[model samples]
Target: MKSRHIKAQITSFCFILPALTVLALLLLYPVVTSVFYSFTSKHLIKADYEFVFFKNYIAVLTDPDFWTSFLTNIKWTITSLFFQIVVGFLAALAVDRIRKGKSFFRTILIIPWAFPSIVIALSWKWILNGVSGFLPNILVKMGIVDTVPQFLSSANLAFPVLVMINVWFGAPLIMVNVLSALQTVPRDQYEAAQVDGASPLQSFLHITLPHIRIVMGLLIVLRTIWIFNSFDMIYLITGGGPAGLTQTVPIYAYNVGWGLKMLGRSSAVTVLLLIFLLMVCMLYFRILNKWEKEA
Candidate 1:
């Protein structure tokens, strides 16, 4: 019996060994190398390097650009999260209450999420173009402005527009998650509330909200991390343009590492961002655990 159990354990390990090796090579290697590179003064094009200890970290921490990018990241994540959750929740509620053409509505709403980020960015860019874009042309015809305004090029407008675009792209994910959770809510809960003469709003608040709260909390945490580290949409849309207003941490790191060829400093930025994200994950789990306990 012991020999059979040992053989079974070895068989399980053999089955997973290839996947474990791939993960180590692809994920763990880069992370470890990046950490090592963060402490050295290395440039992308230069071969020579000197050990810098904490100098790169100090420089990154003290840099104004880093702070600006960090704050912008915070704003981007928070604003996108709020709008996505609100819009997605409303959409889910509406869809949940609908009986006819439900699948059609869901498919249509999820189209934005299915589209490639680059494609979405390019489409929005053309639509919002200062020169002969559809939206600006319409506004011009209405005499809102004599000439087209550059939505993606204006510092003040660019960030908000990027945020809105992110909200559009991300809301579908929240909608799908919330909708799935909503479906799992037992029908009897609503029926019981109805029997007790509960209003529609009351039934939703007392029955629906509690049932889906866990899913909502988890989704928010996941989306927060994704949005915080997001690079592609904003990069494709604005390229961190119009005086670097939309440069989140990842974009800033890319600019530093690739554009400026400062690999060491960029690695430091990456390390800092990783640390921040880890702290966020810890806080999120802590809060989530407490909520679970209370419930």
Candidate 2:
């Protein structure tokens, strides 16, 4: 029996070994290399990388562009996550308790999320384009704005448009998850509360919100991290343009590494981003764990 158990453990390890090896090579190795590079002067064409311990990091920390991205990320993260969670919850509520064909509507709405991100971004770009587009034309027809609204072209307007697109794509996940969680909440509780003369709002606040509060928190944290590291929509729409006003941390890193070939600087930025995300993940998981314990 002992021999068979040992053989089973060994067999399992053997099965895991291939995946472990691939993970080490593809994920761990790149991470280790990036951490090493973040502290050095690892230029693109340099034959020898001089160990300039923390020089790249110092540059990154002190750069104005870094601060810009940090601020933009903060704003984007908060506003986008707010809308995504609120809108998604409302959508889930509507779908979970509704008339006939609500499930079909739910499926149809999630189709935006299923669409390719680049396609969505570029399609919005055309809609917001200055020269003869549906978005500007409608606003002009409605007499809302005397002009085309300058969504993509203007720095002030570009970020909001990007956020709108992101929220549109991202809200569906939260909606689906919240809808599923709502299904698990006891219908008997809702009925009992109703019989006790509890108003709909009171029932929701006292019963529904408490039951799903942890899931809501989880969704908020997930959305925050997702929006914080978002790259594609803004990149596809503006390419971090209009004089770099819309460059988030990810796009900034991309520009530094691929565009300018500043490998070490870009690596430092990537390291910082990873660290920030790690902290957020820890907080999120801890909250979820506590909720589990309480439940």
Candidate 3:
């Protein structure tokens, strides 16, 4: 019997080995290669030099453009996360509580999330343009402004618009997540609270909120990490334009290698962003661990 159990374990390992090997080749190898390249100058001309230690890193750190881009990334992450969670929670509650047309409304609401981000950005671009655009035209008609809004060109206008666009596109995902979490909640808990003379608000605060605390916390971490590394929406919207007002670390990384043709500095930026992302994830994980323990 022991021999048979050992053989079964070995056969299972054999079956899983191929997938493990492929992941090592595709994911692990590239990550290791990138880390190695970060230490050296992989320039286009003159014999590529050996490890430059931290020179490229130092240069990337001191660069003005890097700081500008870093700030843009922070603004995008904070604003988008704040609004997305609130909006998604509200949407989830609305959809879950509705007796009529819940499925129809949910299907319509998730359309933005289903559409490719490039298409959404392009569509919004046309809408927000100062000239003959849908949004600006509507704003003009509402008498909110004297003339059409110049969002695409103005540095101030561009960032907020990007945040709003991001919220529209990404918040649906969180809504769906929360909606799924809501269904698992036992009705008896709410009923018990009501029997105890708890107000609707009190029942929601104590019962509904605690039951889904894990889901909300997980989504917060997920959104934070996602927005930090996000590239497409911002890229297609402003291309980090209007005097680099909307550039992030991803854009900065692209400009470093492709724009300046300096592979070393660009690689440095890539490594830095990766490290920063990992740190943010770790911090979130630590907080999440504590939060879950308490929950």
Writing each residue's lDDT as its tens digit, candidate 1 over 1-295 gives: 9999999999999999999999999999999999999999999999999999999999999999999999999999999999999999999989999999999999999988988989999999999989879998999999998888889998679989998998899999999999999998999989988999999999989889888888888998899999999999988998888788988999999999999999999999999999999999999999888889878
Model 1 error, position 31 (Å): 1.2
lDDT of 3 by residue, 182-202 (tens): 998899998998899999899
Write the candidate numbers in order of decreasing lDDT: 1, 3, 2
Q: Model 2, range 43-134, lDDT digits (tens) per residue? A: 77766777889888899899999989888888888888888888888999999888898979898879878978789977887887787889
Per-model clash counts, in order, read 0, 0, 0
lDDT of all predictions: 0.93, 0.87, 0.87
Each candidate: RMSD? 1.4, 1.7, 2.0
Please say which candidate is ahead in TM-score: 1 or 2. 1
222 Cα displacement, candidate 1 (Å): 0.8
Residue pairs in candidate 3 whose N, alpha carbon or C atoms collide under 3 angstroms: none
What is candidate 1's TM-score against the reference?
0.96
Q: What is the lDDT of residue 267 in candidate 2?
A: 97
Residue 279 error, candidate 3, Å: 1.8
